[model samples]
Target chain A: MKVSAIITLKKDVLDPQGKVIHQALDGMGFENINEVRQGKYFEIDVNENDPSKAKAIVEDMCKKLLANLVIENFKIIGTQ
Target chain B: MKSSVITFPGSNCDRDMDVALKKFGFNNKMVWHDDNELPKSDLVVLPGGFSYGDYLRCGSMASKSRIMQSVIDFAKSGGLIMGICNGFQILVETGLVPGVLLRNKYLEFICKNVFVKLDNKENAYFKNINKDILEFHIAHNEGNYFCTKDQLKEIEDNNQIAIYYCNSEGKIQDQYNPNGSIKNIAGIFNKKKNVLGMMPHPERMIDQSLSGEDGSIFFKNLINNIK
Candidate 1:
C-alpha cells in the first residue's frame, strides 16, 4: 500500500521560508494572499496489503520520525 | 577522565571534539554511529556536523542511528552528555532534550563568534566555571530554538535553561540574539542536568591562537567537575 502524509508547522510556530516565498510571490504581482506556511510531504510504500494498515504504519512513522510533534503536525492524506 | 565522541556518517566535528577532549586530558574514544554500545566514560559528546546530510531534517536521521540508544541509556543513568550544534539538534530529535531548533529567522546560515551567558551553573557542564559570560562560535542554519508554551513554562520552572545569547557585558536582550531563539536561549539541560544541548561549538574556541581560550577554560573546568 502507498500512503501519503503532509507535515506542517504548528500555527504558532514561525515559518520564515514560507514568509519569504509569500514575499517573492507578492513581488511577482500575485495578490490577495493572506499568508503562507511551508510544509513537508512524504509518500511511503508500506508492505501492508490493506489501506488502513498502511495508513497506520505511516502514522506511526510520522509520530516517531517524520513529524516532530512539538512543532509540527502530520496528516495522513491518502492511502492506496 | 574517559570520554567518548560519537561519529555519525556526516559528522564533521567529531575529530575536533576528540582533539579538544584529548588536549584536556580525557582519554577520548571515537565511537561509530553503528556501534551498539557506548564506551565507559565520564562524558559523552555528540559533536557538531551535518549528520545524514541534513536529510528530512537536520539531525533527524542521525538521532535514530544505532549508538543513540546507548547514548540515551547513558543519559538515563545520570552520566554527563553534551551535544553541540548539530549534536544539539540530535538531542532534541531523540527527545532527550526538550524543544526543537527551527530554521533561522532570516533563513540564512549563521557563522560567527557570539557571546553566551551561562544561565545555570549547578550542573556538571558549567558548575564552578570561572566566567559567567563567554564568547563561543556558532555556525548553523537551524539553531533557532522553539518550544510550546507549556514546555517553556516547564523548562523555566525546572531551571533547565543552561545558557543565553548575550553581549560581552552579559546583557541578554533581543538585539544580541543571533538566531532569534526564544528568550535568547542558546542552550538547555535536561531536568536531571546530566544531558546538555547547545548550538555553540566550544571545540572551535579551544585554542587561544587559532581562535579563543574560552573553550580551553570550559574544557579544563569540565574535566575537573567530572573528577
Candidate 2:
C-alpha cells in the first residue's frame, strides 16, 4: 500500500522561507497574494496490504520523524 | 575527568571539542556515531557540525542514529551530556530537551562571536560558575529557538533556561539577540538539568590567542562541579 502525507507549519509558527518566496512572487508581478506558507509532502509504500494500516504506519512515521510537533502538523492525504 | 565526544558523519567540530576537553584536564575519547556503548566518562559532548548533511532537518537524522540509545541511557542515568550547535538541534529532536531550532529570521547563516548571559546556575553545567556572562562563538543557520506557549511556561516555572543572548556588559535586551529565539534563549537544560543544549560553541572560544578565554572559565567550572 502507498500513503501520502503533507507536513505544514502550524498556523502560528513563522515561515521565513514562505515569506521570501511570497516577496519574490510579488516582485514578479504576481500581486494580490494574501499569504504564503511552506510545507513538505511525502509518499511512502509500505509492505502492508491494507490501505488503512499503511496509512496508520505512515502517520506514526509522521508523528515520530516526518514532522516536528513543536512547529509542524501532518495530514494524511490518502492511501492507495 | 573523563569525557567522550560523539562524532557524527558530518561533525566538523568533534576534534575541536576533544582538544578543548583535553586542554581542560579531561581525558577525552572520540566515540563514533555507530558505536552502541559509551565509554565510562564524567562528561559526554555532541559537538557542533552539519550532521548527516542536515538532509531532513538540522540534527533530525543524527538524532535517530544507532548510538543515540546509549546516549539517552547515559543521560537518563544522570550523566552529564552537553550538545552544542547542531548537537542542540539533535537534543530537541530526541525530546531530551524542549523546543525546536527554526530557521534564522532573516534567512541567512550567522557566524560570529556573541556574548551570552547565564540565566540559571543551579544546574550541574553551571553551578557556582565564575562569570555571569561569557563571550562564545555561535555559527548556525537554524539556531533560532521556538516552542509552544505551554512548554515555555513550564520551562520557565522549572528554571530550565540556561543562557540568553546579551551584550558584553550582561544586558539582556532584544538588540543583543543575534537570532529571533524565543525569550532570547541561547541555551537550555533538561528538566533534570543533567542534559544541556546550546547554540553557542564553547569549544570555539577556549583559547585566548585563537578566539577568547571565556570557554575556559566555563569548562573549568564544569569539571570542578562534577568532581
Candidate 3:
C-alpha cells in the first residue's frame, strides 16, 4: 500500500519560506496571488494490504515524527 | 564537577562546549550520539550545530537518535541538561521543554551577539550570578520560538522563562529580538528547572579575546551551583 501525507504550518505560525516564495511569485508578474504557504508532502510504501491500516500507521508516524503538533499539521490523503 | 557533551554527526559546537566546560574546572567527556549509555556526570549538554543536517525539521531527526533515550531518561531523573542553539531545537523536539523554534521572521540565518536578561535567579543555571544581563552569541535560522497560547500561559505561570533578548541596558524590546521569539524569549527552563533550552550559545562567549567573557561567568557559576 502507498500512503501519502501532507504537512502544513499552522495558521497562526509564521511561514517565512512561504512569504519569500510569495514575493518571488509576485516578481514574476503572477497577479491575483493572495498568499503562498509552503508545505511538505510524502509518499510511503507500506507492506500492508488494507488501505485503512496503512493510513492509520502513517497517521501515527505523523503524530510522532512527520508532524510537530506545535507548529505543523498533517493529513493523510487516501492510500493508493 | 563532571560534565558530558553529546556530539551528533553534524554538531559543530560540541568541541567548543567541551572546551568551555573544561576551562571552567569540569571533567568533561565527549559522548557520541550513537552511544547508548551516558557517562555519569553532573551536567549533560546538547551543543549547537546543524544536527542531522536540519532535515525534515530542525532537530527532528536528532531528537530520535540512539543516545537521546538516555538523555531523556537522565533529564526525567532530574539530572541537569542544557541545550544551546541547535541543541535547543532538539530539546523542544524531545518535549523536555515546551514550544518549537521556527525560522527567523525575516527568513534569514542570524549570526551575531545579543544581550540577554535573566528572568529568574532561583534556578541552578542563573542563581548567584552577579550580572542580570549577559552578552551571548546566537547563530541559527530556525530560532523563532512558538507555542500554543495555553502552553505559553503555563510556562509564564511557572516562571519557566529563563532569559529574554535584550539590549546592553537589559531592556527587552522588539528591536532586540533577533529571531522573533515570543515575549523576546532567548532561553527557557523546563517546569522543574532541571532542563534548559535556548537559542544563545554561552560556550561561544567564554573567551574575551575570541568573543566575550559572559559565557565564562555562566559556566563558572553553573559548576559552582552544581557543587
Candidate 4:
C-alpha cells in the first residue's frame, strides 16, 4: 500500500519562504493574491497490504518524524 | 573537566568545539552520531553543521540519529548538554528544549558576528561569567526562533531564556536581532537549566587574534562551572 502526506506550517507560524514566493509571483504580474503558503508532500510505500494499516503507519510517521508538532501540522492525504 | 562532542554526518563545527573544549583544559572526546553509547563526560556538545543537508527541516534528521537516545538520557539524568547552532535545532527536536527554529525573516543565510546579552545567570553555564554581553558568530538560514504563546509564557515563567541578541552596550532591541528570533532569543535552557540550545557559534570566537576571545571566556567559565 502507498500513502501520501502533506506537511504545512501552522496557521500562527510565520512562513517567510512562502511570503517570498508570493512576492516573486506578484513581480511576475500575477496580481490577485491574498496569500501564499508553502508546504511539503511525501509519498511512502509500505509493505502492508491493507490500505487502512498503511495509512495508520504513515500517520505515525508523520507524528514522529515527518512533521514537527511545534510549528507544523501533517495530514495523511490518501492511501492506495 | 571531561567533555564529549557528537559529530553527526556533515557536522562542520565538531572539531572546532573539540579544540575549544581542550584548549580550556577539558579532556574532550569525539563521539559519532551512530554510536549507541556515550563515553563518560562532564559535558556534551551538539555542534553546528548542515546535518543530513537540512532535509525536512534543519536538525530534524540528525535528531533521530541513534546517539540522540543517549544524549536525551543524559539530559534527563541532569547531565550538562549544550547544543550550538544546528545542535540547537536538534535539541528542540528532541523536546529537551522549548520552541522551534524557523526560516530567517529575510529568507537569507546570515553569517556574521553579533553581541548576545546573557539573560539568567543562575544556571551553570553563566553563573560565574564576568560579563553580561559577549560577541558570538551566527551562521544559518533557519535560525529564527518561534514558539506557541503558551510555551512562551511557561518559558518566561521558568526563566528558561538563555541569551538575547543585543547591541554591544547590552540593549536588546528589534534592530539588533540578527535572525528575527522571537524577542531576539539567541539561546535558551531547559527548565532544569542543564541543557542549553543556542544559535550562536561560541567555538568560532575562541581566539582573540583570529576572531575574538568571548568564546574562550565562555569555555573557561563553563569548565570551572562543571568542576
- Measured by lDDT, the strongest candidate is 1
Candidate 3 lDDT tens digits, A1-80: 99999999999988888989988999999878998999999999999999888999999999999999998999997788
Chain A vs native chain A, TM-score per candidate: 0.97, 0.96, 0.97, 0.96
TM-score of each: 0.99, 0.98, 0.98, 0.99
TM-score of 4: 0.99
Model 1 chain B, poorest ten-residue lDDT window? B200-209
lDDT of 1 by residue, A1-80 (tens): 88999999999999999999999999999988999999999989899998888888899999999999999999999987
lDDT of candidate 1 over B1-227, digit per residue (tens): 99999999999999999999999999999999999999898999999999999999899999999999999999999999999999999999999999999999889999999999998999899989999999999999999999999999999999999999999999999999998999999999999999999999999999888999999999999999999
Clashes of each: 0, 0, 0, 0
Write one digit per residue (lDDT tens) for candidate 4, span B1-227: 88999999989999999999999999999999999999998999999999999998899999999999999999999999999999999999999999999999998899999999999999999989999999999999999999999999999999999999999999999999988899999999999999999999999999889999999999999989889
Looking at model 2, give its docking quality level. high
What is model 3's interface RMSD? 0.7
Whole-model lDDT for model 3 versus the true structure?
Answer: 0.94
Pairs that clash in candidate 1: none
**Poorest lDDT segment (10 consecutive residues) of candidate 3 chain B:** B202-211
Q: What is the lDDT, from 0 to 100, of the residue B6 in candidate 1?
A: 96
TM-score of structure candidate 1: 0.99
Fnat values, one per model, are 1.00, 0.93, 1.00, 1.00
